[model samples]
Target: MMEYSDFKFKKMQSQLQEYFDDYFSKEDFLFTLDCDIEDVWNLYLDSFPDEIKGIYHEKPWHDCQRCHLWFKTMANVVMIDDDYKIRTLFDFKTIPEYQDVFRALDEFLKTKRVENLFLHDKHSVGVFRSFAEYDGGFDENHHFYLDLPEKFYEDTENLASELGDALTQRQLFEDTLNLISPDAVDTVLELVHSNSLYRSIQWKDTLEGLKDVFEEFSQLDSNCDLNNWLWKKSANLPRNITHIKNTSMGTLLLDITGGMDLEQAVTNYEKITAPTNYQRPKAIYTAEMLEDAKSKIAELGYMDSLERRFAKLEDISINNVLFANRDVRTTLGEGIFDKLRKNVSRKVYNFDEVSEISLDEFITNVLPHAQEISLHMYPSLKNNFVSLIAPLNEDAPSMFQWDNPYSWTYENNITDSLMKERVKEMGGDVDVDLRFSIQWNDGEWDRNDLDAHSTEPDGNEIFFSRMKSKRTGGWLDVDIIHPEKGKTSVENIQYKHKENMIEGEYLFRVHQYTYRGGDNGFKAEIEFDDTIFSFDYPYKLSNKEYVDVAKVELKDGNFTLTSICDNKVHYLDHAVHWNVALGDFVPVSLICYSPNFWNDNEFGNKHIFFMLKDCINDTNPSGWFNEYLNNELRPHRKVMEAMSSMMRVEDTENQLSGVGFSLGKLGMNKITVKVKTNNIQRIWNVII
Candidate 1:
C-alpha cells in the first residue's frame, strides 16, 4: 500500500465538505447523484485498494474463485450490497482506534463520484480466455467480474480528475505500440484492437489491466533455456512448442545434426553438450499460439469465430461449462484422485506466502478466499469430491448451509414488569423478579469495545463515564472488556432496579465503539423488558409511530417488529417487516416511517417498510388472507413476546440506498414493489 499522506486525505475531505455545504444544504434541491447496487459494488472496488491497503493484504490469486470473493468483500464495503445470501464483509463502523481511517471516509464516498467511469456493459458469468494480447503465463480465464459504479455527475471538476486516470492508461498502451522491440506486445494490441475483436468495457483498473494483458502477451514467445544451454531444434524434446497448426508445420523442427542416428538426436542430453553456451531464440507468435490465444480469447465471449479468423485451426468442443463438471471421480471401491490424497494434508498457506487457514475459518472470519478455494481448479481434471457420496447420504461436506449474520443468547427467564402488570389486570398476583440483561459474544481475536448505555426517564444517562447516575439510579454494573488475544470474551449489560425501575421509560443500548481484530462473528441480544426499543447508539428510531408501526427490538438474534393496539400485540418477523433486494414489500396491518439505517454513509435516503401513509389501499377485508390477518394477527405486548420466543433470524445490517431508484419520490406511493414471500400481506382493522 502506498503511503497516503494525511494532507491528501484532508484535501479530499475538504472538497467533499465544500460540495455538501454548497449543494446539500439547499431547501429546494434534490440529490442529482444516485447509483444502483451493481454500480455500488464496482465503485467501492475501484477505490478500495488504496483505502483498505493499510488494513488488508493485496489479492493473492489470479483465478475466478478469487474474483468472486473480491466482489463479495467489495459489497461489504458499501453496507448495502451482499453476495446474494451472506455478508462477506461485516460493515461495522470504524472503531475509535482507527479514527484516522474512519475519518478518511472521503475515499469511500469518492466511489460514488462517477463522472467518467464506464457502466457495466457486459454481465456474463463463468471464465474464459482473455482476447487482449498478453504473453504472461498468468493469463487465465475470468470466472469473476468487477464493474465500476454508475455515477450521477453533478460536479465537473471531480469528473475530469477521474476521467484523466483511465484515459491516461490507454494512451500509455498505444504509446507502447510505437516501442522499438517487443513484437508480442504489438501482436496482441493489433489483434485485440482490430475490428474483428473489441471490448468497450474491458477493465476499470486501467493501469493494472494493461499490465496484466502485457504480461500474458509477453509469454507468447518465451523459449525454454535449461542450465544456461539452448534446447533448440528437437523433434523428440521439442522447444518453442506452438499450439496452433498454421502452415501445416509441426510445433517445432528438431535438429537432424546431418545424421539419422539416435545418439546424434540427443544433442542436449546429459551426456552431450555441444552448444552449452548458445542462447535459445525467444518464441514469436505462431499458429500454435493461436489455440491458447483462442482459448483465452474465448473467455471474452464470441468463441466460434477465432478458428474462422485464422487458418488451419481446429476447435474442440467441451460439453460442460463449469470446471467442476469436467472433473472425473471413480467409485469402484475407490475414489477418483485418491492417489493424490496421501500428499494433501491440511495446508495453511498457498504460494508459500501469508497465513494458511481452512475454508470454514476463512469464510467465518470474512476473509478473502476467491482465488485459491475452488471446487476444482484444474480446468480439465475438475472436482469429483461430491461424486463419491450417495443420494441417501445423511451428511456431505459439500452441502451448502445458509447461516444468519447476527446471533446472541439471552436470559429468556426474565419476567417483564409490563407483562406482570397485564397479568395482575387479569386478577393474578404479581411478585415479578426479572432484570434486563443483554450479552454479546464476538470472535476470539475481536477487540470489540461495545458500550452499554441507558437513558433513564429522569433525563439520566448511564454509560462508561457515568456508570451510574446518582439521581436517575441507572447503573452499568458490568462494563466487560474484550478478552486478550487467543481468548474469547462475552460482554453483558444488566438493568435491575426492581420496582424503582418503574418511574419512567428506559432506552437501553449496546454499540461497538472500537471494533478491532475481526469480521462478522458478532452476536448481540436483549432481555425482554418494558423498554422494548434498542439500537446500537448513534442509531435511533423515530418514536412517532407511522400508522400503527413502532420501532422493533433485536431480541435473541431475531429480526422482529411489534406494536400494541387495543392492548393486543401485532408482530411480524424479518420477512413480514423487511423487504428483499428484488423490490418487494409485504405490508402488514400498519407500518412505521422507520427507514433502514444508512448510518454515517448517512445520506438522507428515505425508506419505508410499508406504503406511504396516504398510499395504503384501505379496501380491506376482501380475501381469506385478510380474514386471518384481522382475526389471528392480534396486536399486543404479550403476543409480541410470545412470537419473539418462538423464532429468530440473525440481526443483520439493512442499509437501504440504491433502493431509491425503484421508489424515487415521483412514484414512491404509486410504484408497487413486487412482494416475494410465502405469507400474504397482513392487514388489520384496529387503530393504534
Candidate 2:
C-alpha cells in the first residue's frame, strides 16, 4: 500500500542512499494461485508447510487441473522502494468457491493423517491459493495480516529507520568525546573504503574494525596534527570536521567524524605517540584495547539499536546478487544464462517458452526494456550481453534472449539490389526497383513506426494499407510494416512494367508518418530500367518534411525526373516530353524513357529510327523519322520502341534508316522533319 506517491518516500531513498544503488516500482504485480481442494490433499501428503513443493500428480479430470495452478506461492518478499517504504502486502484476487472449499477441506482433513503443528492440528484453514494450498492447508498465507493499514509497511520500516535516527542522535551525544578531542573516534572506515584516514566504518561496528588501521597509519608521525590525518568523505557535510594535533612532533589525535569512546581513543593515541623512551614502544596497543573502545562507543545512547538495523540488512540482495558489501554489486555470469533460460522455459508453467519465438520476436515483445539485446552488436562485450528479468505477471512471457547475435535475419540480409539481381538471374523480372534505407541515433528508430505512401500520377496511392497498385503496375514490393521490429533496414517499393505506366505524370514520394525521437534520416535509390537515381535526406526525413522523391512524365513518351524533394524543379539537360504526332494528325502519349544511363554507356551505335514503328500508316516508320530528326537528343532503339508503342502501331522488322532527314526549327522546342517517304516529300513537326 505504501507506494511512490507516499509523502515520506524521498526521505527514505535519501536516508538509505548507500544501501540502494537503484530501485524502481514494478508496473504490475505477479500471481501465484491454487484452485481447489485436490491441491490441499496432495500438499498434506508432502511436508505440512506453506512452501516446499509437493510430489503429488495433478488431478487430470478436474476442470481447473489443466491450469496447474493448484498451489504456487507468489514470492512473499518485502521490498523497499526509493521512497523507503517496506512493501510486503500486494493486491490479490480471491479463488472461486473459497468458503465451500474451505469448509469441505476442513471437514475432510480432521480424520486425515497430518503432521503435528502448533494450534492448527487436524483441519487446515485459509488456503490463499497462490500462497494457497500446501501441507498446512490454508493456515493464513502470511504471519502478518496484510490488510490496508493506515501505515502499512510503516511499523516494519520504523524498526530500521528508528535505529538510524538513534544512531545519528548517539553521534550527537558523543559530542563530549569529539569536543574534548576531535580525533576521539577511530577512523577505520576511511582505511576500508578510501585510503583517506579520517572517519570510521559507516556502520556502528567502526570501532570494532580499527585493529588493522595501526599499521597503515604507522608512516604518519605520531606527533602530526590529527586535523591533517583525519579525512572527510563528502565536502558537503553539515558541519566542518576537525582533528586534534599536538605541536613539537608529539602525539596527535585523528579527527573523529562520528560517535567514538573518547577515553579509549585517547588511550590508544597515547600508546602510539609514546616513544617508550626505549628501542621499542611506550605501551603496545592490543586487540583488547580496540574491543574496549568499540564497547564504549556502542554503549552510547541509541547506538545499540543501530546494530539491529545492520543485522536486518545483513542478507540484503539486489538484481539477484548479494549487495551487503559496500564495495561491490553483482551480475550473473554467462554460465548461468543457459541455466536461467532453461528454468524460465521449464519451471514457469503459465508462460509460453521463450525459445519458441525467434530472438527478434522475443526482443520485440520486451522492448524498450530489452534494448540491451543489440541486433548489430558482437556478444563478446560484457555490456552487449542481454539481461532479461522474468516477467512475473501471469499474462506476460517469462524470458527472452538473443540465442545468436552477430548473424543477420532472413529479411535483414536481403537487400533490395541483391534480391532483385538474384530474382532476375533466376528469370524473375524487376521492371522497376525502388529502395530506401533509414536510420536514427541510439535506438530511437525502433520507436518510429515508419510508413511510406507513394501516389502514382493517376492518384492511386500505394501504401502499407493498400499494397498493390495494379493499374499503375505499382507494387509495394517490399515495405517495412514495423520498421522498428526488424533490422535497421531498407524500404523498397516497386512497379512492374505496364502499358499505362508511362501514361501521364508518375509521381512517387516517401512519407515518414511517425518520428519517435532523435535525428531523422533517409537514403533512397530508384532503378528504372538501366538508370539508377539516388537521393539522401539527412536529418530532414520526418513527418513534417515528407520527401517528394521523384516525378516522371510520360507526355509524348518521356519517363524523366521533372523535380525531386521539396518540389524543387531539378531541370534536366533536355525537356522530358515531346510531341510524337502520327502523320501530323492525332497526338498520342508514349514513353520517351531516355534515362541518364542510356547516354552514359548502353547506347552503342544504335540509331533512333530503330525504335519507331516499321509501319506508321503505310509510311516507312523507321526510315521516316531517321534523317530529318535530331538523333543527338534521342536514346537507343529500345527507348524508341517504347516511345513508338504510344501510338499503338506495329513495329515491323526494319533496319535503322531515317535517310534524308531535315531539322526545320533551329533552336526551338520543336523538331520539323522532311523525309522522302515512298518517293514523295513529307514534312512533319516533332516537338523536342
Candidate 3:
C-alpha cells in the first residue's frame, strides 16, 4: 500500500505545482492541478494489489503492486525545495516527460550532495527569449524569476528524515507475520465471531483465518465434523433441527458404535419421550417436525385408525361430552328417561303461528291446553291489552253534554249584605234597587199640561215613588184595569204580587215610532200606567209622587189607559238615571260568543261604552242615548235581544255612573266576562 507522511505529502504538492507551471500560466496552472492530483492519488491507492493492504491487511510487501508503483513514480523527482515548490519557475517543456524528469530529479537529490537550487519553467524561459529579441530592448523585469533562499536546505532535510521513519515502519511490519500461533488463531477467530468489539477487523481476514484453524483442527481428529462447526458459527442457519442434523450429519459428528443412525436416534427418542400428546398428535401439525412425523405415525399404526375411526370419535365426543348442554330441547312424556332423551335432541317452536290466536283461544287453548308452556302467559297478555285500551274508554263519557244552569238555591247563592255595607262605609252609594220604567200611555200626568206648564224640565228626569195600600180591593182583585181611555196600551204582561202588592211587570210596546236617520238631538216621552207626558224642557227629579189617569187611542180605537205623575213627567223615553245616593242603576249584563267579539261590536263596529252607577253632570244625554240605542237596538233587530246582550256593570268608586257604550267582544263572540265587582262602575264584556 501507498504510505504518506506529513512532510512527503507537502513535498509532493510543491512538485505538482512546479510541474504544472512549467507548461502553463499561473491562472491555468492552479485550475488543472486539483484534477490531476485527485486522479493520480486514486489510481495509486485503489489499484493496490494485495490481500493484506495495510497494517490491518497482513499480506507481504512484495505482493503489493501499489507500493512498487509509488516508489517507481517517486524515483525521478529531485528533492530541491525551490525546484519542487509548485509556484516557482521550471522548464518542464524542455524535458520530454516532465513528470518523469521531476521524478528522476527527486531520486538524484536524495543521493546527491546538492545544496542551493533555483527552478525555471520552459514557459518562463521562452517569454524571456521573446522579450530579449524585441526592437527597443529586453526588459528582464517582465520575465518569471526563481530565487532560492538559504533556509530551503534545512527544511528539505527535515522532510527527508520524517519520510525515512515512515518507510522504516513499513519494513518492520512486513517482517513480523511468521511469529503468530495456532491457538492464538482460534482466539482471533473467536474475536471476529459476531463480536462487536472486532467489527473494525476486515471480513476477508476473519474468514480466511477461521478456515485455516478449522483445517488444522480437522486433521487432528479425522472423524471430526468440520461442516457442523462451521455451520454453528455461520451467519445463516436452517430453521428446523431435522434440517440442521441432516445437512451436517457425517461431517459434524462421528458414530463410533453405530447403535442407531442420526435420523433414527432422533426419531426413536421423539416417539417415546416427546411432549405427551393429551390426544393423538397429527403428522403435519407443525412445520418443524413435519418430515419425521410423516413416517413415524405410519410406522406405529396410529395413522390407519386415526383416519377411519378417531376423527369421527373426536367429533362425536366433542358434540356430546363437551357441548351437550349448549343445545336447548323441549321435554315430552314426563319422566327421567324421557327427559334424558329429549335433552339429547334440540327442538324450537314457531312464534309467528302462536301469536295469531284470538284472546279466548290464547287463554283457553294455547295457555291452559298446552302442557309445556310458561305460567306467566295469562297475566302478561292481560296487562298488554289493558295498557292499550283503558285510556280510550275512561275518557269517553265526558264527551256528552250536561245541563249546568246558574242556580239561585242556597248552595249556589253568593250575595253579601256585608259587601253592601263595605261600599257605604267607603262613602259610596249602596242601594241595589233603583228601578225605572218606560211607559207608552198617558192618564195621570198629561202631556199637554207638562208641555205647556211653567216648570221647564231637564232633558232627563229621575223620580222615586212608593206604593200605598188600597183597602177596598182584594189583593187578587188588583188586576190590570182601564185608566182614562186611550192613554196607554200593554202586551205580553207578566205580573207578580208580594204583601198584597204586585211587584214586577213585563210588557212589549203597543206602538213605536221610527225616524229615518234622525239628527242628533234629545227627545223623551214618559207614560205611567196610562198617562202621556211629553217633555222638551230639561229637568231632574229627586223625590216626588202624584198620580193621574190618561187615555190614548191606537190601532183603530182600541183605547189604552195609563196612570202617571199628576202634571209631572217623572220618566221619559231615551232618558238615563243613576241613583248616586241609593246606589241603584240598571244592571247591564254582557254575553260574548267568540274570542273575536271584543274587537268590534256584536254588529261588527268598533263603538262601545260602559254603564256606571253615578251619572256625572256634564254627560251629554242626547249623545249618550244615541250611542246606547245604536249598539243595543239597530244591530240585532230586537230591542229585547240587544238589552239581553249588554255586558253587566262592574262597579268601581271613581268610575262615572250612567249608561255609555264600551268596546265589545274582540275576535270572536264566544268568551267569558268577569263582573268582578258589585259596586257599579264601567261595564263591558271581553271576548278571548
Candidate 4:
C-alpha cells in the first residue's frame, strides 16, 4: 500500500512540474503559498486518481489534471489553512466571529471576478508581473478571494506619514481650483507624480480622481485664466487626498489647506468676500408726531371711533402704532408687534421677521384703515412693544411711562422728571434723593397681598409691620394690604428728606404675604442719586416666598443698582417682563360683549344675539385685526368664522363687540374667553 501511494505522488509531482514548465517557460520559479511543501504534495496527492491494485496500466488523468491547473492558477496565490479553505496571510484571530475571513471571501465572489490575484506575498512581485503580461489563465467561474496583506497595511500607515511630510503648505487661497489651473496643471501633475507619497499604489487611485476633477473644472469654464490667477494668488495643494468628505468647494480648500476640517474650511471659504454694508435708519416718534398721526386719523374721518379705541390704548399711544412702521408681512398678513409679542413671550426678541413697507403700501394698507388698525392694536401692544420700539424711536418714552415696566426691561436713562412724575402718581415722596417702592397689578389685586421690605445701611428692616426706621429715617409709606380691586397698588419706603439718605448698600426685597388670587407678580423701582432702576419679579411667589429684588450700593454719593433676581437682564432692561401676560396681571384692555337685547321676560323661552360692530368688511378686519383674533382672543375657530360672517358689512351704527347667533329656548349660554394673548387655553367662562 505504501509503494502504491509513492508511485501516485511521484506521478502527481511530475504532472505539476510539466504544467509549470509550460506556463512560465524560462521564468524563475515563483507564486508559492505560505504552507509547507509537504502540504502541497499532500493536496495534490488527495486529488490524484485512485489505482486498481494490479490493474494500473495508465489511469485517466482528467481529475488529477484539473486539480493541478487550479493549484497553478489560484491556489498558489491563496493560502490554505489546516481545513483546506483558502484565506489570506493576515491573522484574523483578534476579530469577532462575525468577521470570518472565509465568509467575506464568499460574499466577494458574488460581485467580482477574480483574475490572477496575488495576496502581496514574497512571490507577489513575479506573479503580479506575469499576470499583467498574460491574461488568458482565469476560468469562466468568476470565483473570488480577498487578500488583506500586512505589507499593504504597512504601506497605508507609511503613506499617511509621507503625505503629511510631502504636503508642506498649510495656508489656503480663496480660489482653490486656481491652484491647479490649465497652465499650472502640468507643473502640479509633475509635482504629484515626483512626490514619492502619491506615487505609491495606495494613492494611485486618489491622484487619478484629483486630475479628473481639475480636467472637469477646466472644461466647464474655458475663458478663466486659472493659470494666471494661480500665479498671482500663489497657493499650494496636497500631494494626495484618499477621500474628500465636504462640498467640492470645501474639498479643494482641504487640498490647499493640507487637511483642515471640512466644515471649518467651508465656512472660511464662504466668508472670503466682504459682507454687504447696510445701516438701518432710526425710527423716531415724538409727541408732535403723535399729534400729526392723530391729525392724519382725523383727516381720514375716523376721529370719533379712533378715540374710543384710544381709550383702550392704556399706556400705549397712537404714535406707537404709526412708528411700528417696520411692518411685518407674514403669510397671514399680520403686523410686526404681535409677532414681537409672541417672540418676547418665548424670550426671543429678534426683529429678523420685521420688514419695511413702501410708503405706498403704508398709505394703501395702513393709513386709510384707521378704525381697523386702532381696533386691532387696541391693548395687546401695551408693554412689550415699547421694548421693540424704544431702540428705533428718537424720543422713546421713558421706562416709567410704560404701565408694565417688566416689558421694557433694560438699563436706560431714567430722567429725574420721569422719576418725579412716577413718584407723584404713586403718591410717594419726591423730595428724597433715595426711594424704594413696590407696585403690583391684577384684576383681583385686593385678594393678593404683597409687602415690600427694605434693609437700610444701618441694618434696620423697614416693612409694613415696622413702617418706620428711625435710624435711617426711612418710612414704609403707602402700604396697601388690601389694595383697591381695579387699581395697581404701591408700597413705598423712602427717606422723606434728601439729608436722611445714607451712603451704604441697601437691599430691597418683596415678600408674598398672601396669594388669594392667581399668580400675581410685582414690579419694584428704586431711585437714588437722581438715577432710577426698575426690577420685575415676573414669576409666581408662593405665599411665604421672598424675592431679593436688587441691591443698591451707595458710596461717594453715587448709586449703583444690582438686581438679585434670577431673571437674566433682558434686551431692553426697562421693557415689561415678556412673560407678565402669562401670569395674573390684568389684560392691558378688556372689552365685554353683552347682549343688546335679551327676551328675558320669559326665562325658558329666551333668545339672545351678541353683535360684532365696526366690521369694515367681511372676515374680521384682515391684517393686525386677524392677528388679534389668533393671538389675543383665540376664540373657538368656529366662533371666529361666525363673527366674520356676522360682521361682514360696514356698520355706521350699532357697533358689534361680540358675535353669536340667537340662542333658542335656552336659559343660559357660556362662551369661552381668554383675557390675554398669552393665554389661549379657553380657560375662562363668559355667561349670558
Q: Write the per-residue lDDT of candidate 2 for residues 500-568, one digit (tens) a residue.
A: 464676666666667665355655555553444555555545554566767656555445656674544
Cand. 1 TM to true fold: 0.17
Sort order, lDDT high to low: 4, 2, 1, 3
Candidate 3 lDDT (Cα, whole model)?
0.25
Candidate 3 residue runs with Cα over 4 Å from true position: 1-75, 78-161, 181-186, 189-688
Q: Write the per-residue lDDT of candidate 1 for residues 310-372, one digit (tens) a residue.
A: 000011011100111111111112232233334444333323223333323422331111111
- Each prediction's whole-model lDDT (CA): 0.28, 0.31, 0.25, 0.39
lDDT of 4 by residue, 1-688 (tens): 4344434434433443444334332222112333343444344344333443233334322223443444343443432222323333222321232124323433333222212213232222211101112156532211112223243222534654633432222123223453434332332233234321111223345545556656655564454444322322221233343122233433433443465443243335334421221111111122333455555445543333211110111233322333211121221233544544444323222222333443334333333222121122212222112111111222322121122211111112111333333434444565576787777774455467888898888888999889987767888756777665555677778775645678788888888898876475877777765445666666667888787877887776666775465453121253222222222222222121111121111222222222122211112221112122222223222233222223322322322222222245232443332222222121233333
How far residue 229's Cα lies from its native spot in candidate 3, in Å, is 35
Model 1 misplaced regions, further than 4 Å = 1-441, 485-488, 519-522, 529-688
Assess the local accuracy of residue 346 in candidate 2 as a C-alpha lDDT between 0 and 100: 25
For each candidate in turn, the TM-score is 0.17, 0.26, 0.13, 0.24
Position 208, candidate 1: lDDT: 34
All candidates: CA RMSD (Å): 37.8, 38.8, 53.1, 28.8
Q: What TM-score would candidate 4 get against the native?
A: 0.24
Better of 2 and 3 by TM-score: 2
